[model samples]
Target chain A: MKADPKGVLTGEHYLDGDFACAEGALAAGCRFFAGYPITPSTEVAERFSERIPEVGGIFIQMEDEMASMNAILGASWGGVKTMTSTSGPGFSLMMENIGLGAMMEVPCVVVNVQRGGPSTGLPTMVGQADMMQARWGSHGDYEIIALSPNSPQECFYVAIEAFNLAEKYRVPVFIMMDECVGHMTEKVIIPPAEEIELYPRRLTNSPPAEYLPYMPEDDLVPSMIIAGQGYKIHTTGLTHDERGYPVMTAEAQEKLVHRLINKIRLNADHIIHIEEEDTEGAEVVVVSYGISSRVALAAIDEARAAGIRVGRLRLITVWPFPEKRIRELAPKVKAFVVPEINYGQMVLEVERCAAGQAKTILVSHGGGDVHNPQDILEAIKESIK
Target chain B: MEQSRTEIKITGFGGQGVILAAYIIGKAAALFDKKEATLTQSFGPEARGGACSAQMVISNSKVLYPYVKRPQILVCLSQEAYNKFEPELISGGLLIIEKDLVKPKPAENGIQLLAIPATRIAEELGRRMVLNIVTVGFFTAVADVVGEEAVRGAIKDSVPKGTEDLNLKAFERGFQYGKNLREHGE
Candidate 1:
């Protein structure tokens, strides 16, 4: 479906990543935003608040992150695309409700403009430490879709994709942006509304008497219905059957949870998105995402100038891990060099996927700033040895 | 590509439009000039009255490293900014300063310096807040990184709706000052 022309601001503009993300959400038909503003990520909420009135939407400054997350989920079920943005501390606060959103199959977008972590470590600094947290933060065995965009331009496109995936999969999609990309300013070109594709909410056509809220289609994703519609639906966080009623039994949990996980896992091939370069015959592959990918490219260039066969694998989709591609390249490359702002989070997934077929080296920074290209170059050089 | 890449740093006390100056330059290069530009800034937690610095990299190709390592062009509107960031300027780099606010010691390693009374020019124009636009004009003329028309378009796009006329006049004054300094020996 084409994006709504009313919400699309089609033009070239110099904007930061946060503003671009807000524009992207609007372009993707996000009409409701509820978030507690935090540094770095605050601009996303600010932009939404400023533009939502003219764009015909609701911008709520929720009291806290938990309420913010809950409000978005409620809004999504109320039949509007919704989103919330935050940094580390607020991200932690939203986890429980995020889990509930997942369990209830509510489609919404959650953007984590990550900062240095542990406990409000650096509110305004860059950090990718939440990579693991983004994947497992909400708990339980449910699957998720997370994207990492490297630039302000990509942030615009990624926000739209986040919404598309959320509506398509009936799950909360995460846009795992870091403080650097969130704050860095660059040129972002938003295309015309007719050119932008959007995924409309998967509304069921079943009659009110026959509609089963949790019943999966052939794709394993159940259709959603808006609250207060004629259709009777029971959405809950408890383990439930196809009728959306809680069934307290081991089999019921198995059935519901398995479908929730497999909806993403079974369709991982279609959902996983990555950008690869020069990996065909390279001995070392530099695997990175978000802001680190841009820095890693500089290192890759330096390594290449020094006559190293280094390739680039930038993860556009961080979650679902792109394990197959890693496994394929693991046997061919001598090692995989992972440079991220966090201390060795995503590298663990790379190592596990490599499965001793190739080495995995981590170029880690504890945050506050991006890694020096020379440090990543050193890691790339070390990978060959 | 390395020779074509121009790294610029603009620094001043907050409320001086330091970031906005960088934004205009970046917007000029990226939006109007059709080049790639990335701007990143650093400042204290205060909303105003703190030291603030913005760095930008304008390149023909993609800017892989977003932050400036050593700026080739440094513009300082305050003495503290000059003192803090002066040592990091590359040798033979272009250093632009506000003559009334900053006091430079001596040029070393063939570094070139250009001074403009941006605040004085803005004051003469009856709007002291447009000092950053004056500096941007001076930098555009002297540094010659981005085209004049491109910066003009960016300024018109960026500044408040009613202030474009005044800001453009302030820009012209600084640009004329810079042109004079470059044509004759300064």
Candidate 2:
């Protein structure tokens, strides 16, 4: 489906990543935004507040991240495309409800413009420390989709993809943008409304009386009905049956929990997006995501100049990771070098996927600025050795 | 001079619009000149008048790393900025500074120093607010990193809607100064 013309900003714009992200959400038909302002990530919320009014949408400044999370879920349940954005600390607070959103199968987009942190470590700096947190912070055996963008342009594009994925799977989607990408300014060309594609909200064709809220179709995703649509619906954080009623039994739990995980794991091929370059005949491959991917390229270039056959695998969709590709490449490449802003997160995934078939080397940073290209270059050289 | 990549740093006090100067240059290159540019800035704690800077990388290919570790062109609008960032300039780098604000020691070997009275020129333009635009104009003429028409178009697109004429005038004043400097071989 084409984007709503009212929400589209059709032009070439010089925009920062945060503002671009907001534009992408609008263009994706996100009509409801509830967020609490936090540094680095606040620009996303601020832009939404400013632009939402013009598009005849709604932007709510919630009291906290927890409320913001719940509000987006509520808005989604009301049949509106919804989103919220926050940083590391706020993201931590939103985890509980993010799990709620996951359990209830709420379709919403959450943007994390990551910063240096265990807790508010550096509000105004870059970090990719939230990768693992985005996957597991919400405490449960549930799955979510997350996309990492390297630049403002990707931030714009990935945001739209996030919303689309959220609708497709009936789950919360994450745009894992770093502080650098959020604050950095670049040119973004927003396509015309007709050119921009959108995934419309999957509404139930089943009549109000016959509609079952949690009934799954062949795709394992259930169609949604708006709260005021005269359908009797019930959704909670607890395990529920097709009728959306809590059934306190292991059988119900098994059915519900299994579907929650498999919906994403089974569709991994369709959900995963990676950019691979020169992997053929490569002795070493550098695995990276978000801003780290761009920084790693400099090192990759330097390694190439030194006559090393190094390839690059950039993870655009960090979650539902391209595990199959890594497994395929592990035996071909001598080693895989993973670099990220965190001490070590996604490297663990690379290590798991490589599975001792090849040497897995991690170049970890505590996160303030980006890795020096020379440092990554050294790691690539060492990996080949 | 036209390498695969060029890194630029624009530094000054917060109110001097150092970030805007970088933004305009980036837009000029990326949007108008069709080169790839990425710009990142330092968001210090202080609100106004504190140390402010923006880093940009322009490349024929995509800019892999966004931050400018070693700036090829360092434009300093304040003395403090010059002192703090001067050490990071490459040996053969071009140093552009505000003549009245920064009192440099001597020009080092392989370093080309060009000074402009951007703030004074802006004051003559009837508003000190356009000082950054003037600096942008001078930088365009002196550096040749982006075309004159591209920078002018970027300035028109960036500044406030009604103030385009004022900003363009500021840009022209500094651009003329820079052109004269090049012609005189100063």
A341 in model 2: Cα distance from truth in Å? Answer: 0.8
The reply for model 1, stretches above 4 Å from the true place, is: B1-3, B43-47
Candidate 1: tens digits of C-alpha lDDT, residues A1-385: 9999999999999999999999999999999999998987999999999999999989999999999999999999899999999988999999999999999999999999998888988887899999898899987888989999999999999999999999999999999999999999999999999999989999999999999999999999999898898987788999999999999999999999999999999999999999999999999999999999998888888899999999999999999899999999999999999999988999999999999999999999999999999999998898898
Chain B only, TM-score of each candidate: 0.96, 0.96
Q: Which one wins on TM-score?
A: 1
DockQ of each: 0.70, 0.57
How does the DockQ of candidate 2 come out?
0.57
lDDT of 2 by residue, B1-186 (tens): 124899999999988988889999999999999998899998848526866789999988887888988999999999889998999999999999999999997989699999999999999989999999999999999998999999999999988899999999999999999999999966
Q: Which regions of candidate 2 fall more than 4 Å away from where they truly are?
A: B1-3
Candidate 2 B-chain TM-score: 0.96
The lDDT for every candidate, in the order shown, is 0.93, 0.92
The digit string of per-residue lDDT tens for model 1 on B55-172 reads: 9999999998899879999999999889989999999999999999999999998899989999999999998999999999999899988999999999999999999999999889
Q: List the residue pairs that clash in candidate 1.
A: none
Clashes of 2: 0
